[model samples]
Target: MEQNKEMTAQESLQLISESFNKSRKDILRGSAKYFMLWGALLTVTSLAIYLLWHFTGKPQWNFLWFAMPAIGYPLAALMGKYDEALPQNEVSKMLTGVWRVFGAFAITLSAIAVFLVPMHVTLIIVIIMGLAECMSGVLLKNWPIIIGGFLLGVGGAVFAMLVKNDAQLLIFTLGGVLLLITGLVMKLQYK
Candidate 1:
């Protein structure tokens, strides 16, 4: 007990420095899987959008898909993983809020698709999903979110290709509306 009390300030500082350095390294090492996961999601979305749009006979915005997921899964999964590696108490909680919002949006989108109830409103929802994905990427400092956004944009355009000119207008309109809603909702919960 006496020896513990006699510990020097310099020694404590050194210990802290060492611990901080170790944590920093740990964060970097653990981030890879998350980044890759994000990247893969972006890449898949990009490809899906490209196919859908191209199949619909619209070649105008399809080119964006090629650049969609340059990062891929491993890089994407590592995104917040880096933060997790740090001595993050506050930041982690905040980031998880974003993740939670994202998860909600995901569920909503999945429900929409699974129900097979396509509507003008549904198109709007899809757009919202796209924007949510993009925002998530930005918040997390993940490139995959940007890629996801681009893919969503492409996907929206692709939807236009599937229908006639008159119907295209409706789909595009709702898609934009829903995207706006999605973005807003996601932004509200943004940490």
Candidate 2:
């Protein structure tokens, strides 16, 4: 039989703190792969869309942007499955919640841009992506991610504004490169 010992408040708080720290480290370790994965997909898709739109002279090729999520979600799901052994914690839950909300916002805004509005959807999406990444960095206490998000969000937006027509798609490529570097930094640092 095990004896039950009551923990003091200080000891309980310490245990909670330890758990949170451990959860954070685990989440950060796994997040690098996701950054790289999405970054690669975004880069490739942007290039493809750019080439198709350029050579074919069809602006409708812009719809190919949707392929990023189509490919990324399944791969991410597989990665998440592999990581299922790790216990769920508050940090993980919050990060997932943040991304889910961002995804919804992106999809909704893209749809609205395609169907109703004549706004700069690429600029808006890049900003949202950067905000989401920066929020994740804030939660994970990662500087590289924070800096990357700021560059992709602000710099990319400015670049998008300056470039014309098909050139705007290249902004996604720049954002993708930033994300890829951020992920590499995280992988090396965490390892």
Candidate 3:
């Protein structure tokens, strides 16, 4: 009887450990929603900007990029509400904090870009996004995210070096495509 009790206790402990690990995985997987949303938004906006500038040659079209922050903030707030309702673990809390800081930095950089060097806005934004993505991946232990971040960084560098003047639209379009593909792959893999 004592041996049976011991075995049962061991089994119970094992089950509890497995359950905790699974919960963590679930929280990590939930991140895919944000990735997909941003991916789609970037892809569509980049393409639209590219087409508009390429055909019409209007600099004002660049202002459309602001739509990202406008849309992203509300969506992030909703997601944060949902997250607040859930019982988050330490890892989840840390991940949230990391992203919050990233958002703040992005906003600050954007404001500076608007006031100072508006022409390099796309490259600056992409590089910042790449760093954020890489940091998130490191924190979450997600390889796809890390790879995606590197791609964004490389794309930004290429854009900065190769494209000058209004032709930078190509870089934005390419970055958008890379983001979209990365998000889709992450969603499918994590789901």
Candidate 4:
């Protein structure tokens, strides 16, 4: 009877381990695609903002930043609809929570920066985004993502501070590149 209990416990542990592994794979696969999508969108939007603002000498071009989510969210939703359904798992829930918080915080800060407070909004957002990426990488145990996030979060922050005027938009371009690279790496590894 005691041996039976031990076997049952061991079997349960094995089942849990298998579930974690399976869910991690599914989540990482989906997330890799999202990283690529957002990365490309960010890169293109940042460049467009930089050009329009630089040539026109109008800060209002910054408003284009909002277009990112306008496009990204719908595409992401569509992609989610197609992805194989993932099982409920701790890692997935944690990752979802992290991104949700980030989205809310970013939206709030962007609104305040645009409407009420004129601050170094670009750098602040980049830093926060980097930290979030790094956190995601840590959760996924992906080295490229971790490194990319560190570079974007810390190095990008420093670079943004040093660069002057409209040049700051280039930081987003760099961030997008990093994210793109990370996504490619993940895709290759996971595939």
* Number of clashes recorded per candidate: 22, 0, 0, 0
Which stretches of candidate 2 lie above 4 Å from their native place?
1-24
lDDT of 3 by residue, 121-141 (tens): 666766777776677667667
Alpha-carbon RMSD, candidate 2: 3.8
Please give each candidate's TM-score. Answer: 0.41, 0.80, 0.77, 0.83
**How well does candidate 3 match the true structure in TM-score terms?**
0.77
Q: Output the better candidate (2/3) by lDDT.
A: 2
- Candidate 4 C-alpha error for residue 152, in Å: 1.1
Tens digits of lDDT, candidate 1, 106-169: 4555456446754443355446656655765575465744675657656865785576433443
Winner on TM-score (1 vs 4): 4
Candidates' RMSD to native: 10.6, 3.8, 4.0, 4.5
**Highest TM-score: which candidate?**
4
What's the C-alpha lDDT at position 10 in model 2? 98
User: Which candidate would rank higher by lDDT, 1 or 2?
Assistant: 2
Q: Which candidate has the top score in lDDT?
A: 4
Q: How high is the lDDT of residue 149 in model 2?
A: 85
Worst 10 residues of 4 by lDDT: 1-10
